[model samples]
Target: MTEPKIAIALYSYEPQEEGELLLLEGDILTVLEEDASGWWSGESNGKTGLFPGSYVEYVDEQLIESLGLEQFEEISEESNNTTEQDLTQQQGGEFSGQNINDENYVSDEENEKDNTSQNQNQQEIIQTQNFTRNIGGTTMIHDGFIWEEKEPVFKVTIGKTVKRKKLRGMKKYTAYLIHSGNFCVTRRYKHFLWLRQRLVERYENVPVPPMPEKQFQGRFGEDFISRRREGLNRFLNRICEHPILRSSQIFHHFLEADEYQDWKMGKRAAEKQNKKEVPFFKSITCAQEVTKDCDDEITEFKKNITSLDKCLKNVENVATDLYLSNYQDLSASYLKFSKAFLKLGSEAKGIVGKNLDIEGKELKERGKEQRKIFIDPLKDYNRLIQVFIETIKVRDQANFQYVSTHAKYTKQNMGELSGQNRDKLLLKQDKSDRMTNITLAEIELFHYNRLRDSKEILTNHLKTQIEYYRKSSERWKKVKEEVEKIPVIHGSKKLEGMEDLSEPELFDEKIETDTEENQTSNQIDKEIEKNDEDNEEEDDEDTDDEDTDEDDDDDQTEETEEIEKEKDENEKNEKEKDEKENNDDFEKI
Candidate 1:
């Protein structure tokens, strides 16, 4: 039997069965067998499953070879040019390519040779253009330093919960980046922590911004997750602003690498490169200075932790004393009241009394449960705060040792007379510096990790608080429903005189009805008045229009009369002229 070949996944596959593997896009998988159907059996991320064969493709050897050839040619050409230039300089004569008076010295044969060389160069240029077109104008360059200016765009989306081996189901956040190409990486809060740690380790001088606080209580809450997504966006934007860090190989791999193993390897390589063994003496002074600078921040952090501890304790005390204690007291009182009601000897009253007794007992039990819910989470929170404080104390102690050793080393270096004494002081300083560096690193790691844990503890406590209230509300709802179910028992009391109560109730109802009737009548009258006003306004407008129409009709009649008079005058004038012309013609004849 031959070993199965490996193939790269072109698209992500979410398996439907437990045995099936979850394959991310760009993941390398071992192909075991092929089925008659399009599905092929493959193993990825240590899980074997059937995947669609079309979703993956084998790595192409030709493409890899072409990429290598392009890089080799570029390097070879540069080296050849440098060698030619060097040889020309070593000969101590004018370079052959230097310009000269061609008319005075050059022959026809030399001119022909130059023209042929020029034609050859043009042909090479034309060939290069054709080659570029053949390759879709996108060249694959192998030089690691070759970088293009591309603005990275980040988008985050909350994905489905995924169950992993030996761990609780985790919610996935898929981060998509648009840079040279569209790249997507799915991660959780822990992955964010890992990235932050690496950034801090690699870029010591750069102030790495904090991530969204881990929330255990609302770890899956929509609003919290949204805020976290926004925070992640800001974090990436900050990372992009740094010149050196933005161009980092690891950073690029983190954004663009499709294969998880390849990305991890790149990160590991970056970390190794960043790791440096410091001279003990030099690092001791630096550590002391760092401790001094961080004093205020550390103190502030401690104060916050203390304040949080106190707040948690106060909440626990309130829940225990005010709520639980009150519930217990109320339960006892209700129990005594139930006994009194049972002694009344009415069946309905007895049932109500029994229900009240049950309610009291239930309330008491709920109080205990609520107390546990509040106190248990608080205890864990307090413990976490205590741990944080202790860690800070240890950090302070380490700083004290660094400062003390640094002072001693400085004193010895300043006053030492003998060579041996000076050497010993130097050795001590080196040891001190090494210890200081280690301690400082530890302190920083502790500080960040402690804050992260504190946030988780607080989140858990808040979740517990929410659960307590929810359960309490449910219990109260049940109590209310049960109380409503109990039948009321009638008794001979002064307040229960139906005839007297009926008169007042009937009077009140009659008054209410009368008031409503009056209101309706008033509203109707107002509407009628408004309508009358509107009608009057319309009538006035109509009257105005009638008057204007009459005036217009009178004006038209006058104009017609004037026009008829003018026509009559013109006709009379024409008849007179005709008569006169007839008389003149008769005289001429």
Candidate 2:
């Protein structure tokens, strides 16, 4: 048999003339023919040219297939199994590592046991033993992303369990009520963790929403439980929203299974069937509207996801900071403010102190509004973004397989055109095409859903912000008005000159300088406006007599003695004394 002409370049070569092939080290070539001269004519990188015979080393074409297949097989094997903890893929929150797919697999001893009566299943399995039959392939995709729903949404009516009774009255564990749509089942955190694990393992083509990170120490706390419950709800919401996942047997089993034994059987069945490779994708095809070449679409989708994730992540971070700084401790901080004000108001013994109490209560209400209207949804949105990214990553895995198989077929196609090789090539081509189709479908579905979700989440987020700000502004405005109603002498205790604040200081040289200073909490006297006209009449007289130094000084001395006689009563009686003292004390507090 004539060996197939193949050579590996031993040295780099730059083409010096037209029709001469360029050669780099290790460059493979097809040895078309050789002339009697030292120069050898060959095809390299699609160019037919002659090169120095010494620059190339020939190898048997048959070895290439064997070697290439070994490397590709290793890649395929590695992809099937990965050791790194994919924190984002499985139980998103802190969860003990558990393999849902393997844990659910039927064991030898269990298989021998009668499963029919012991299933204790809440819902009946398909009589035909195929759940997909009812699920139908048509519903799994909308423009190619699986499970685009048009009929009715798969909803988790209650995601968070407000109460968890101890399992079997055992203090060691608590069973949370996990409800999906009409089904309600008691499940532990581990069960949810495993569900996510199985999903990540089984659907290399689907992104499993990550659970919230585990809360180790505070897991039992009400706040932690509430947050985790909400997070779990969001996770389930994503699962239900996914067209492919909505009818998942394993997920349904989790939601509807009654006894522990039945849950095990359902888990086993779900996993055993997981060995079947993307059975749901068998009926799916790339739609006509999608681009013919999936590589371009994938590239475009990837770029778009990168930009979108970056933008969303940044927004999520900003919201997180806002929540933490402003609303997380909002209740505690505001209540503390209320305490200080109430204490100061008691000391002031005037309307100013009463108004301070109102201000404090309004602060508390402002914090409450922010947390209710804006904080929760923003947090939910942040978690959703992470889930969306993990889902997008599923396509990367599928793309890898497609690229690997395509490479194998392309290399093998370059080999000897034997009957057996031709058949293998056809199979490889079909597989590559199938992967391409699925990837394209997912890209379309992902893009559409992302846009839809973003619009929905964004609209809700903005509306909440508007509501939160609106309530806060109106509350504070009310506070400002009440603050201004405080009597001048009783408004603030330590504002030395505020009590003497003239209603009309327009003719005074110091008027401009004192204007801003007089307009603070110290000026909360309701009587100021009523005195404006009365005081304005004295403005012209005061300005005209400014240069009568000796007479004005003698008159001031007589008035000072009278003021001194009343100083003791006025000193503690002025609201400025209490207001100033309150401001200083609150700052320290």
What are the models' TM-scores?
0.29, 0.51
lDDT of each: 0.49, 0.53
RMSD of each: 37.8, 23.6
Please tell me which predicted candidate would have the highest lDDT against the true structure.
2
lDDT: worst 10-residue window of model 1? 133-142
lDDT by residue for model 2 over 1-589, one digit each (tens)? Answer: 2334766654445555777776643456777766544467888656788776656656544554655634423332232222111211222111123222232234466652543232322112112122233224333334443445534557774444544446675655545777665678888778889898777665555566667677668667766676666667777877887766666667777789978899988887666556532333434443322223445666676677667667766765676556544443443333333323322332332334444434444544554444433455455555655665565555555445534543565476653333333333323333334445556655666667667866876676688667766876776676677667766675554743333323443222132234333333223332223233323443556555774776889999999999997996797678778999999999999
**Which residues of candidate 2, in runs, are more than 4 Å off?**
1-151, 159-171, 259-261, 276-278, 289-292, 326-418, 463-589
Error of 2 at 71 (Å): 43
The TM-score that candidate 2 achieves is 0.51
Clashes of 2: 26
